[model samples]
Target: MSDEAAGRRPSIRDVARLADVSHQTVSRVINNHPSIRPETRERVLQVMSDLQYRPNRAARALVTSRSQTIGILSSSSTQYGPASSIAAIEAAARERGYWVSTANIEPRDPSSIAAGLAHLMAQSVEGLVVIAPQMRVFRALAAQPLDIPYVTLQSTELDPTHALSVDQMAGARLATRHLIELGHRHIYHLAGPQDWIEAEGRMRGFLEEMSASDIPTTAPILGDWTAEFGYYAGRELLRVRDFTAVFSSNDQMALGLIHAIRDEGLDVPGDISIVGFDDIPESAHFWPPLTTVRQDFAELGRRCVDVLLGPVGDSAPVPATIVPELLVRSSTSAPRPL
Candidate 1:
């Protein structure tokens, strides 16, 4: 039963040798210490990958109390936007040799949110990534006593220190303005549920842009961030058929709207131009190729890990809000001559 009679597994020294690094440097890399050089880090990672080396989490925790884990608190959502954010966070965490513990909760239920937080805390998570789309989630989280570093994926700007998010308002404005500049005076907005922070921010952006342009507005159709809801809303909107365009809050809803429009024998852009937010992968493949706003979910994920740990070195740049881009395609066009 003694080690002398058994074979030894790969050790830090073995990795150092193959990586052409000192054991100290290997330790720094394993711990994800900020002081390690990028080139050295990459080289060590490659060597470890080639050797199929995995750090002993239990052994490391015994010595350094470093679990090498991050926790994610997310609301249950099938919507592409929130789901993509969660996937991005997990991928980013794994790239740095960290494990992710995710706890899903209902954003509207304070008790559920509290329970989720308590569960993550019990694991002694080093940091937290909160995918809180609803304002109520923030309220619930703010009431908790948190000691670990936490970053929220939201544009609320309630806490500049702990908040990191895509500029939802700016992205919404980009979509809305695209419609206005197309000479479409009569336009509608299909917005998400009013309680959600992202939904509110986007709706605000749409209204602001419309008001600034001196464009008269009808009340936006609040949706459930579902393609089904978008379809139903589109059907209702076409009853009057007065508007020449619509800006959907997310791509799923836009797809629904597209379906409804086609059901009524209407053409996208030929009669009613459509614009959408959150350029999910399929957005690019929609019938006319969706004209939508593109969010850098992958970058947001990387920034979450980076901000949680802070800058790597003195010269490293701090993480900032990611700007969304507008993608124009066949889905939109200038209004037809009256």
Candidate 2:
């Protein structure tokens, strides 16, 4: 049962011997030391692979005085954006041989955020990827200083140094402008919850575009970013009948809005055009196919890992900000004849 009785376990020395390098060089490669040359690093890693030389986490921690683990603080893992980003972060971290731990904090209370951080600390994570997109989350994080490095997956405007998020404002503008170009002067916005940073950016973009076009803005209908809420909002908007198009904050709400419109004997893109954000996989299969903005959560997640794991003095020069694109479909058209 002992390692020596079973042909002995490979150590850093074995890797160094096979790669024709010193044990210190092997250590540098394992720790991602910046001074190691690219060619030498590759050769050392190849020998490690050939020998199946897996570093022991316990010994490495004692030797390097750090955990090789990264923690993720996420808000809602059920939502598409947050869930996708979390998955991508895990994948990216695994590719670099770092373990990932996630703590989901739904409560907006400061104590909840603290509890989440405590959970990750118990695991001795070296760095953190924060996927809390609410305004209160940022306030909670800024309330105290952290010893370990942390990166945020929120609005770029929040933390210019470590933000990794898609341009929500630009995406919202693209959605709204699509309706405007189709000759829909009276447009309505179904915004998400007020606490969300993405919702704020999107609402700002919608208002900016509307004001720039000289069109008087109607009060936005705030929803909970659910298809059910969208349905209710759509049914209520029927009484007003003033707006020709509606841009929901996300695809779930947009689908619900379409259902409500159909139930009221109204046709999409004929009586009312609708646009949504976060082009979820099912958007294309919707009744008339959904026109929405597509954000690259995977790329955003990869960038988060790159910034957190890169060398201290040579961190990513620019914060990651993904640009969203408009995907046109059958869900939008010019206003019908009055």
Candidate 3:
């Protein structure tokens, strides 16, 4: 072997010298930059192959001050929607050769949210994706303004440039409208907790749809997005059979509601029709199959990464919005003949 071949590991300059190219051109090729001429790139790559050269990530990051890492701040990571979205975000980031740092905020308090943010910041993330669902989370995020570009997965009038949303409101409206069209004049809404952004959107949609149809809107029962809550709400509802149908904010609650109604010797669609949101995997297998609205969590996650890496790098923010679709099933039907 030649003395040069026997020398220490090859560097960018070594590859550049052998390929008769500038070190900058070599760097561009290493980074897969688009501007390098095809022939030049191929020659540089061949030289690199001959030298067994590998670009040093640490050196590049030190020079760029970019970890090539993104942070994810998720408040409801355990839930199906947020969990699925986070997975998709990770997958998308992987495809782009980016690292993901995740922080799960379990508490709604200001301290917890701040701590979560601080944790991600410590990782030296170049950008952030916030999957915060609660209104309080938005408040907490605002309290500590972030220096790095970030994207929020919520729909609100505030900070439109940094927000991406799935039309939770429209999904709710579709669910309620389905019941209305089925000739059910009286309907109840099972809403998510008061402070959750998604819950608020779903509730607002239900109200708007009910008002538009000239149907009297019964007060919605606030649920904790659990089947237990649904079961309890169902039991209590047995005392007063005021509505012909119920629209739940999520499938989990709908599951509980179904159990409760069945325990009370009531037949779904036969006595009280039902609808739900977030058509989780189990929704299709629910006792009678749940009619629900589906949100493309995967698509939403992909968009979050795209927007963050795009205009965000240019210091220009672009918001992304996706709509939801309603799925009809056996859970809903026209009210029994009066």
Model 2 spans with C-alpha error above 4 angstroms: 1-60, 311-319
* TM-score list, all predictions: 0.82, 0.81, 0.81
Tens digit per residue, CA lDDT, model 1, 111-224: 999999998877778899888778778877778978888888884466567888888899999999999998989989999998888888889999999999999999999999
**Of the candidates numbered 1 and 3, which has the greater TM-score value?**
1
Query: Model 3 — TM-score against the truth?
Result: 0.81
Please identify model 3 stretches exceeding 4 Å from their true place: 1-60, 311-319
Models sorted by TM-score, best on top: 1, 2, 3
**Residues 1-338, model 2: lDDT tens digits:** 24552497778888887799999999999989999999999999998898788987766776787777999998878998899888888888888878898998865678889999999887778899988888888888887677888898875777767677888988999999999898999899999998899899999999999988898998888899999999999999998788899999999999999999999999998999999999999999998899999988777777888888773356556457789999999999999964
Give the alpha carbon lDDT tens digit for every residue of 1-338 in model 3: 34875688888888888899999999889877899999999999999999888878667766567778899998899888888889989988887779788998865578888999999887678889988888778876777989998988874565577888898889999999999999999899999999888999999999999999988887889999999999999899878887789999999999999999999898998999999999899999998999999998877877888887773345544447789999998999989853
Please tell me which predicted candidate would have the highest TM-score against the true structure.
Answer: 1
